[model samples]
Target: MKGFAMSTVNIYKEFTDQKVTENVKKVSVIIPNYNYSRFLNERIDSIVHQTYPVHELIILDDCSTDDSRMFIAEKIKTIKDIPIRTVFNETNSGLVFSQWQKGLKEVTGDYFWIAEADDSCDPHFLETLMKPFDDEKVVLSYCDAARIDDDNNVIRENCQDLYNMFDSRHWDKAFVTEGSEEIKKYLSVLNTILNVSGVVWKNIPGLHDIFEEAKNFKVAGDWYIYTKVLEKGSLAFSPKCLNYYRKHTDSVTSSVHCDIEYKEIVSIEEMVAQKYELDMETYRWQRIRRSYMDANVSPEVKKKKIAWVIPYPGKGSGGHRTIIQNVNALIRHGYECDIYSEDDHRTTDEQAAQKIDEFYETCAAFVYVGANPRAEYELCFVTGWQTLEMVRKIPAKQYGYFIQDYEPWFFPMGNEYLIIEDSYRRGYSPITIGRWLANKMETEFHTPAQYFDFCADTKIYHPIEEIEKEDAVCYVWQPEKPRRGSELAFRALKILKAVRPQTKIYLYGSAVDAPVPFEAEKLGIISVQECNELYNKCAAGLCMSASNPSRIPFEMMAAGLPVVELYRENNLFDLPEEGVLLAESSPESIAAALLEVLDNKEMASSMRAFGPQFMKDLPLEKGFAQFIRSVDHLVLHTEYEQPKAEQIYTRAPYKAADEFRAQALDILYTDEVSSTDAAPAVPSLPRRALRKLRRIAGRGVRMIRQRIGKQ
Candidate 1:
């Protein structure tokens, strides 16, 4: 959208209207206090005034130096309806889960709610939560709780808002799903059950053992407990916000990134996956969880000023859009970023900034058209293959590459290829956009590299309702860029047209080519909004790349469009099978795969449903967080290990030797020209040089493959 504005989600409303006295049985309330004296009185009263009867109330004070113990003692004397018991520990238990275990041991009832001393809930909180335990299989039940401050002002409307990264329709309403399903679908990624103050658990057998295991984790113990406890039975949720989870501003913004806490989080995630035999998406959800964690961390030191030496970009290039998006992300983190473009633009700073705002995002980056920097930068990052040399020439304390692709693959097996490969051997640190690139750098180039997850801006690319569906395929047709497989797509679309002429082909993301060899509509250079519209209406999307996968497939899937791409090593690590079909690298194979999506209604519907679901876990903001952390480590000189990216795909890459031999000749030559025929017309050269260097590559199939094999 030209005038895109981040939509404000104001889900806050006073839900003080509903009342239900639906009672099941005795519910034990545990109040664990430390130094929360001011909130203790309110916390005690919220538990005491529960609409559902409390069989017993246990108050455990962990050596509070404040007036918490005095407030607890005062409240204990006034309690009449519930059996009140108070225990004041002489020494503070190092772990909160220790307090949890002690309180659970003292519970006389079969159900317990651990109400943190700092939190306060509504009068009907217990009654509403207790209603779900009517099913014996329901081991856990919780409701949406809004965030509050010490003044009782709601800071956040609902905890469900945290789940927007993975799911939008869930946790907003009541649900009764199997505990295993909840763990696999929701909790396995990160802790979907956010705050423990909102949950009520049934005291099933072996619950204490889980609690004992939770004691091993200091920060994520509550999250561990939730995953473990859900193994006992089913889960029940209520959307009503009768619980108020308190948050002190000092505690939130003052929080620092704790490495131990993160280790525990991933460790528990691995544990849950192994226990359930779940198909792990490789920390996809944790990217979202880290955003929640990173949001809280207030870096004390200012970030080093950065200069992203970018190539002068055309209006809607995906590469340029990604660079601008990252610049915007850094700006939000208080880093001053400058864009130093080549003099090709021949524009002033104001014009450069205006053009960026027009073409890409509304960037806050200081845009300068020339390579000479007016101001010094602590770090200079290169955004493309063309900028690496320029960035190296620039004076900076640090130089790094924000590589989107193995640029060498964009060229043939010649000087251009060697030049791009040599760029990797440079001393500058590199951060790639996806794991496969990282894998290449680390395994081949032997440089430890970090890569951010490939994700789409879900808010911008998601499915738009009321769009009429069409039997069309939207091809990511970039002609000038040879890696985009212009010739391959032309042949494939021709094959598809011959088989199913009714199927329409829409070419986009590039300028109009002199007339492709098939029946297709050339809708080049569309807006972000228009791209999403194409994604929504089209049955399938084609982004034929022989190098690092572009952001197109992710965007297509984000808009609920099934995608088709070449089956290659570069895509195997990042592209999810649910959203994309990795067709064999041949025109016939590509056409047949496209046909499957167009003709098979069951498969298409399944793909459409799964694409959005897969992307919901990998929204753009999540990718931003991962990138920020990667750079933060670089700038702050922090020690971190980049996770080794491996392929989730098990299927072998399909080899098409005959098709390759023929296509290699097809690309370099024309059909047999007779003596009467003039020289073969040369209009458009190959788009993105084919990574055809494989069986068709050593400069020309067996040669390139032989060289690659030798290397």
Candidate 2:
């Protein structure tokens, strides 16, 4: 069966944009034939039936003893459309490289394909292969291939993976990149661009010098030529297996010549390392290690691991709970999991494991912050803004983010805010908790986010058997954390109590033993069971989250209670389901909304019923299920360096921190600007505070600089 796929290269330019270079239209096809007269007719037929037009076809015979001379002479008569050229050698050239150099001397075309006489291809081979030349930097482009016997019976369905054994399956996907990047990563160790019969490269001037150099090696001539030509420019790769590579008992490559091929492979790698200025020691070590692993390692015995960088898990922290859940889910999916906490030097791995048992009661592996275990992980999850620093210190093949919330808004618009904001722009794929954060991350920041919506554990937080309501309203209040909007919530509650003097108010989630001109019950942090019971006792509940929709709102809905929240993008985008009331972020708007729920019995009943139904489709396991699926797909399908979109903040201005701080203070304190020619001057932080902030911020700046340098 033949497979077809359009490359990432846009096709309009190749056919209709009229900006296509004339070089792209001119393709010189050189067929080098030996004793394979039986396969010559099939090879010629495949090239003749191409969907894309070719400029010329040259058939060179290397003193073949078979009837190939008579067969080609008769077959050349039926090909009436394209320009044809033929070369017959008086003596056997003995080397295929000689025939190639001979045929290239007589050809004049922008690109060339050495279509071996024993191979066959799909009609779309040239059409797909030539698209990459539209990029002037691409020196070569190639496709995947299938192995067939002399009778055209399939031997191997896809052989590209067999060649790409050191790295992951890079050839299974399509990419267009600079040759230097591809060379240093994948090509430095082995020739992943396999099967010259399935390849095509540009007819650049200096390329012939590399061909002459390749004549030095009898076994790995193609490998030498590919490595040398790539040094000139970029390359394009297609995963479509369109070429048919014939393998027979008498094929030249059938016998193993390990000693010679190994020496040549090392020599070519050394040349590539010097050309790209790669670390010679690292290159040699990696080459030897990869060769060892390729020979000794088996897929069944391979140890797969996933690491997580998280803050120490404490009670009542939703983010920590989410991390534990993710670890448990990954463990269930047959991965050994590791957790690294920040600034924990005292606890050993066993002690950390004991702590996890006390809190989450799971058997997943644990690693202390400074333990520094030795194992190669397939992926690492950077769970917070600070974790990016930890990730910078760790080594992993693939990196991702478990963005629980947008942490930048947690601080005022200052240096800390800008630093936290910069963490999202570090080019890691983010799997956010809700659609609101996902959309915000993807659209505003231009970094794509995979959204995983959450659902509650119905078994734990279910409605009571009998419906009952008390004369009190409850609010999850934490005055110290300003993002909870405690001051605004208090004002709204004061207004709410004045109108309905008979009902009582209850505050929970924090212990604020401060003075207030109100009477209420304050329940300091309660357990999951107690919170569910409190929801059943209250007539209405209020929870405020300015950054992301908190889990408490869903918990309240699950317990069959009506909830009131601020109508912000963070909430509106995620909690569009019924059973919740959204009010503008004002005391008056919130008080009116609470009154509407308490005053009408019919609306209350409908909201209580809508809560459970809205949450039914969202089972508690759905988020983790999606999370594991995303992790698996990203590890197997995506490139090591996933493509990054254009960033939003071009001039982030963090270097001028003092000026930025003063301007931010001006904007925060003063409502209007003065009509003066000079810029307004605001007070800066104290000298001691400035020094401390700089010391903390210096690390982040260096990290950003290092990241930029690598790019």
Candidate 3:
């Protein structure tokens, strides 16, 4: 039989080689077995008869107590034409570590298919599963599966419920009719579900490490593995049921008979909570446990607590300036505050110390904000570089991310993604300084954010009475970054200088290497005290951005100077009508906008006057209040409890009270609840009636399966 199988394998190889190169056919199926020889032959037969021919089959058996190893060895010997390799594990090392790890190590195929010992696949499973891999973006793929009983009868068809399996915005349309809008929605939803065995990852840089990390996880190992894969690339799903998932009385999933199967189900939730740094709510804990067991917890129980921590910037950078102004305003308005930063080393800066001490009197606490090895805080408020390092270390219920600008660009690419990804994964409520930053957080990072305009000390930034409209002054500290679009401003200013020599361009910030093209005032870098003077002397400020909607427009406006704003066409925020002199990227366009503002004294005057109104309307205090409210709403409305009538009324105050009243009344009258008298009356139905109901259900299932087959 072995000799005959080898001859058959040679013939098939010859036939395949004559027709097509094996390189075009890339998938290999690996089956790892332990014991249970009863199903070994059928599992191998299923693979041999697959419509799509895979490159090879590698079977590794752990020394089984039963004859399963012998049966698999016999099957391999019989299938000589197909390249087959069999290795026997000296001892049973368990399914995940021994059999699966051995297969992972030995398999040389581009993609691997794992067919479990008891589970079998349809003839077309390999062919269908491999189709999605044609697209390079598809790093992982999985097909819908059916739950089969011991006799191979499908107890439930379409058992791969991706929506229920993963906590993602995608999955609602996973099983819609193909090419339809519903199918798109399903794909969108399925994109987020991480199914490890159902997926085939390319031999990328991090694949092995991901698998190893997953093996280390005691529970929710599959989720940990799949999520790592998803972070690297996109996922694809097949609606058709190719694999049959064995549902037995003695299966590992079946053995975990907890109220909520913590070993199996709780891992995903726990992983999600830890990843996002979310406070595990009482209802969420109960719901997770309840999925596996009929366990109950009190609704009134408080599972987690939240604290708001903020890092104070003591220096006079834009971030610190805003924080100081806001803190003072809050303190004056009777809101309790706290201050934390690197220890105040400059005792001579009397003004800074006075402000700090004044704040300290009203603040709940004040301490140096740094890596505190011994201290633990529930939350940390952070700004600038401190946010990148300190925020993650603090195990906080809520994070108040006060983003003043798109600061990530200042860091390297990988570091930028790390900061953004961490914030997004940790579920921080970001309070952004501008609309552009807010939209980027929402669209790119998929994190919820609210926009608040930067606040200035109106007393410091008041209009300069002695200043007169002469020449437009362009002041930028670091004008090298592409996003700043400073080079465009330079070109425009050069043209404007030629057209009007009297115009003086004052360049500030970092300019160590680059030479000034024009005879301009090069104040390499200025102190905070000098920034106001620059604003006071300038007739109009030059502002430009390729990506960010910068604070310069608002800053110049507050200083009673019209702004020549050169921005990208797809600006996320709407520009001010009168105060902003909008310019395109082209030098000609920038010059044109600059000339218009320069030539029209009346328009410039109106813009300068309109600037104060814009500042007044968008005060930081009002914006901060709105930010607090938005955070409150998100925390309150997050899906913790299954919405009760009272919860609905409280959470959704916009809904009419009468609507909730009617709903409450309906719930009270529903048959879902039973009285003590009704409980005694609710006896089991007669045997004949119960049998009749079961027969009807069985008939319905059969009819549905037949209909599906016909379709």
Which predicted model would earn the best TM-score? 1
Off by over 4 Å in 1: 1-303, 653-711
Q: Report, for all candidates in order, the number of backbone clashes.
A: 13, 0, 16
Stronger candidate by TM-score (1 vs 2): 1
lDDT of 3 by residue, 273-379 (tens): 33443221222322333333323322122122222334443322444555544544432322223444543354333343355445332222233344342233333
lDDT winner? 1
Tens-digit per-residue lDDT, 181-243, candidate 1: 888877876777767888998988897888899888878888888888888889999887777
Q: Model 1 Cα RMSD, Å?
A: 13.9
Cα RMSD for candidates in order:
13.9, 22.7, 30.6
lDDT of 1 at 189: 69
**What is candidate 2's lDDT per residue for 541-615, written digit by digit as tens?**
999889888878887888888988887767766664467888767555676678778888898888888877777
Q: Candidate 2: give its CA RMSD in angstroms.
A: 22.7
